[model samples]
Target: MKLICYLSLGSPSLEQSKINAQNYIDAGCDVVEVDFPAKDPYLDSPYIQSRMAEALASCDDYSEYMKTIEAIKAKNPNANFIVLTYENTIREIGISDFIDFCKRNHLKDIICVGNTHPEVRKELISNDLLISTYVQYHLIPEEVEVAQNTNGFIYLQAKSGGKYHDEYKDLKSIIRHLREDVKISNPIYCGVGISTPDDVAMVKAAGADGAFVGSTVLKLQEKPTELKEKIVALKART
Candidate 1:
């Protein structure tokens, strides 16, 4: 299973973000999700929003974030990297310009948590960048359509909105509906409050491609060894 670790760039500090990302990669994370700190990330829960706020307050500039990406790539040449951000960030930089920057930096995947218009999706596809969007717990017809047309994968978020247990059924149901009902074959990644190795196993067993661990890792920032162990365990479970 693909283990994607979500981290906010420049959170607490850029140096710390770099260190955390390196630790995640070393811990067996297949992908490190770099979040562009937005002023308002509505799709995120309180913990993630707080992290983004802290990151934005410390460094609002995207230049340092871009450099962080380059630095991470330099040290971990084979590590897969994806940017998770709101649409406002893309609009601010202009879509084509953003795609050019991603191409130059070798960042191929983009998970637009917000601001997913058909035109924007089309443009990103034209640039050949892998595009992903969230699939909410309460599946909507529109989201099913979006899933069918995604360039990369589908991010499945639970309804409860935070890291918790008992979401396996919900996740399984959604993936089944999308795959069996909607007949969309995109890779479905379960996120939003998934933390433990058991959680990862449950999702993967339920037909998900992987689990996106975000807030849990951030919470373990001070405990690097424990965090690494957690990531390693999650990877092992798959």
Candidate 2:
């Protein structure tokens, strides 16, 4: 199982964000999902929203954000990275410009947090960029179709809000359904509400190919040792 860590670029400070990325890479994260700080990150949890807000306050320039990612990549030459941003950011940067920027930076994978238009998807595919498919616990037919067609991993939301639902709780069955019923062969990665080693274990046990962890990892940015420990523990579960 892969351990994917999320980090908001320029959070706190660019230098500190670089350090955090390096720490996570050294601690055995297979992939780091770098988020472009947005003025409003509505889809994220409070922890992420706060961090992104701080990141934007520090530096909202898209070029500067890509520079930071480049620096981190230079240090960890083999480390994998996936860009995470909202559709609004894409529109703000201009889709073609965004694609060019990512290509120039060697960033091949993206997880756009809002509805991506078909034209945008077609353009991304033509540019050889992989776009992740997101599936909620509700299991709508449209979501299943998207999952079936994606070349990238399917991002399965573990939980939406503070509330709980049986379908959400039964991730194993959901995974099975996606594979058997929906005929989606893409790797399924569960995120949201995954914050601990045990949570990582649970996702792995449920047959997920990977787990995306954010808030829990971000909360320990100040304590590098603790953060490394947490990452190592989480990776061990994989």
Candidate 3:
């Protein structure tokens, strides 16, 4: 079973991502999902920006992003880095630019969460982007069909919006439908609200090809070494 750890480096510096990467590597995680807000409504609002770096940090700028990526790579050279972008920002930048960036980095995968075909396909869907969709919970067979049409991986979010849980009861039904009904042959990975070592076991047993754990790992800031150890333990399960 492969465990993909989501690293939300919600910080002013690249410190969180760097630490998360090192821990993820040590923990035996198969990949490290590097996420940045594609667009945050509160970024423009001073009230929230005062509290959250993801709300206040200037991570969207290309230079800052590149620097952060370099720091993360330094920490774990072999760790798979899948960049997670929100649909809005990706469409805004033009899909071509996004594809070009991923190709340049040799990323095995790149995902546009909450994105639609009409918003992206015209630009470079046929290119080698290796995209993934975030239908999350409440998926339709067509959503799986659309993702299949792109010939990319499927990102099954465990909840509505972005939330985590100990066990998502809906996941099994959704995965079963997507597999048996939609005939989705590509890889199936789950994200959202996965926060603990035990949660990892639940998803893996639910027939998920992998699980993306974010908040728990990111919050393990002061004790990255310990956090990575836990992750590695989960990776060894089953």
Which candidate number has the best lDDT?
Answer: 2
Tens-digit lDDT string for candidate 1 (183-224): 878777888768888888887887888788888887887799
Clash counts for all predictions: 1, 0, 3
CA lDDT of 117 in candidate 1?
A: 59
**Candidate ordering by lDDT (highest first):** 2, 1, 3
lDDT for 92 in candidate 3 is 65
Candidate 1, position 186, lDDT: 72
Instruction: Name the weakest run of 10 consecutive residues (lDDT summed) in model 3.
Output: 42-51
Model 2: runs farther than 4 Å from truth? 116-118, 159-169
Candidate 3 yields a Cα-based lDDT of 0.65
Residue-wise lDDT of candidate 3 within 1-238, one digit each (tens)? 5688766554544655565567677767788777555455332234223324552364556545656776667656667877766656666665676667666666657775553555464454567667776564766546655766765678887655643333434677777777877778888888777776676777777788888776666556568676867676667663
Residue 9 accuracy (lDDT) in model 1: 83
Evaluated at residue 13, the lDDT of candidate 1 is 91
For each candidate, what is the lDDT?
A: 0.81, 0.86, 0.65
Cα shift from native, residue 106, model 2 (Å): 2.6
lDDT of 1 at 181: 71
